[model samples]
Target: MPLSESTVLISEVGPRDGLQSVKSVMPTAAKCAWIDALHAAGLREIEIGSFVPARRLPQMADVADVVRHALALPGWTVMALVPNLQGAEAALATGVHKLTLPVSASEAHSLANVRKTRADMLAELRRIVALRDAQAPAVRIEVGLSTAFGCTLQGPVPEDEVLRLAEAAAAAGVDEVGLSDTTGMAQPAQVRRLFTRLRAALGERAGAAHLHNTRGLGLANCLAAYEAGVRTFDSSQAGLGGCPYAPGASGNVVTEDLVFMFEAMGIATGVDLEALLAARAPLRAGLPGEPLYGMLPEAGLPLGFTYADGRLPRTPSIPRQAAA
Candidate 1:
């Protein structure tokens, strides 16, 4: 299906990818409120949580609860990350709208992160697809090839390996295949070329760009991908995640900055900037003392700027007390 000019889907991954890397766990009530506020801001798709073992990632221990709450929201395409078939089963049981499986294009990173070889990860992908087919026909499966741009462990990851994994993910019966700059080493030129090639390889199934700002090129890279005809962009509320194994790296692209960039250019992201900022308050309250990153929120909106929707700039009026 062709991407419509009216809207771009910016799937928020803060609850899942953002919180996972943090040391503190966001309370369930706070998480539910955050999801609701994001939905109110016109964000239709959200990665609610990841279905990993609670013992391994305590931050996402309430994945099931979060998924349930997000599913309750109308028009929300709730998503969850599943590492393998086991995680896939758990996510399916929660009736999430989508399930994403991580497949590393870098052999070294794959081994280090998931303790599985590249071939083993592909095998697991096939198993997860089979399980999805059997149990949840409505659930869309996305294979996110991590370290597609470059790997910290192995230095330079070849483009051929990334293509190979994309083909493998499609052959393994995934609905979509996405590329991730897990190590934050991607450049805009590289993003354009790779996403172009992926479009040719996967056709309509080419998935969103999951980028990082560790090297400060995340937004630039995303713009390149957008120029290359990518419509879906994955971002976090406050830029909340990073590879726990890879130190000094930023997580996914910040949602606030991404929304601002698109809306400023009249790209029509369908997300309200003010409401998006309002969503951040709950995130801040949830993860106290944790650092939240966003350029738009810090710099404020551009002078005399207005959104295409025309609902902004009008602050909700507070009811006044009756005169005595």
Candidate 2:
């Protein structure tokens, strides 16, 4: 199906990426409620949780349950983060729509995050793909190369390395390969150039752009990737995540603001901004006292503007039922 002009797939990663980075744990029931509300807001895709070990990420200890709840929602593509072959196995067992494995482009970052060099991560990806092929061929595997723009430990990560990792991920048998600005050090020019190069190297296998607003360039970098032909974007609601290892950092690109930007530009995202904002309340209630980020929410919709529903004057309205 062709992508709708009024929408883009703003995959919410708050349950997985956002909550995992924080200290408190959101109850599984609350997580399910949040996911349900987001689906009600017209979010067709959601990264519900990660399949890592509870010892490693206690916040996602209920990933399997979250996946089950998300799958019960008709038409929603449930996604989860899987760090290695074992995590991939767990995700595949849940019958999720997609499983993303993080492969850092920066060798230093890769070693620090996953305790593996770049080559070692690629090998793990290959193993994960092979496992998926043997166990659950229907599940899609996505390799997200984190810290692609620049690294906290290794400054100015070479575009050559990023391109090489993209090529390696494609060769490693992943269905898709994405670039991530984990440290939020990306600029628009760098995003455009790298994504353009990645497209040339991996063709359609070139994956989504996972950007952070840590340095306040997340949206700009996203626009650059869009200009470079990326259709899918990974964002967190309320900007609710950050690198757990990277101290003093914020969350990924805010889903509310990102949807507002795309929908206002007349680019269909298939998401209701008002409903999307409403979904945030559960997130707030789940975490309580956590700082959420998004300019569109605080400032409200622009004056004299409209959304996909043809509502004018920029007033927030209840979401309409999606067409069958």
Query: In TM-score terms, which candidate is top?
Result: 1
lDDT of 2 by residue, 108-211 (tens): 88887888888888888889888888888888988888888888877788888788778878887888898988888889999999999988888889888889
The 10 consecutive residues of candidate 1 with the worst lDDT sum are 315-324
What's the TM for model 1? 0.94
How do all models score by TM-score?
A: 0.94, 0.93
| lDDT value, residue 64 of candidate 1 | 98
For candidate 1, lDDT tens digit of each residue in 1-324? 125664578989888889888889889999998888999998988988888889989988999988998888897788999988888888898899899988888888888888899999899989988898988888899988888999888888999889988998899999999999988999999999999999999999999999999888999999999988889999998899977655555667999999988877777888888889889888888888999898877767765666755545445322233121
List where candidate 2 sits over 4 angstroms from the true fold.
4-7, 308-324
Which ranges of candidate 1 are over 4 A from the true structure? 309-312, 315-324
Q: Give the Å shift of residue 164 in candidate 1.
A: 0.9
- Clash pairs, candidate 1, are 241-251
Error of 1 at 227 (Å): 0.7
Q: How many clashing pairs per prediction, in order?
A: 1, 9
lDDT of candidate 2 at residue 152, scale 0 to 100: 81
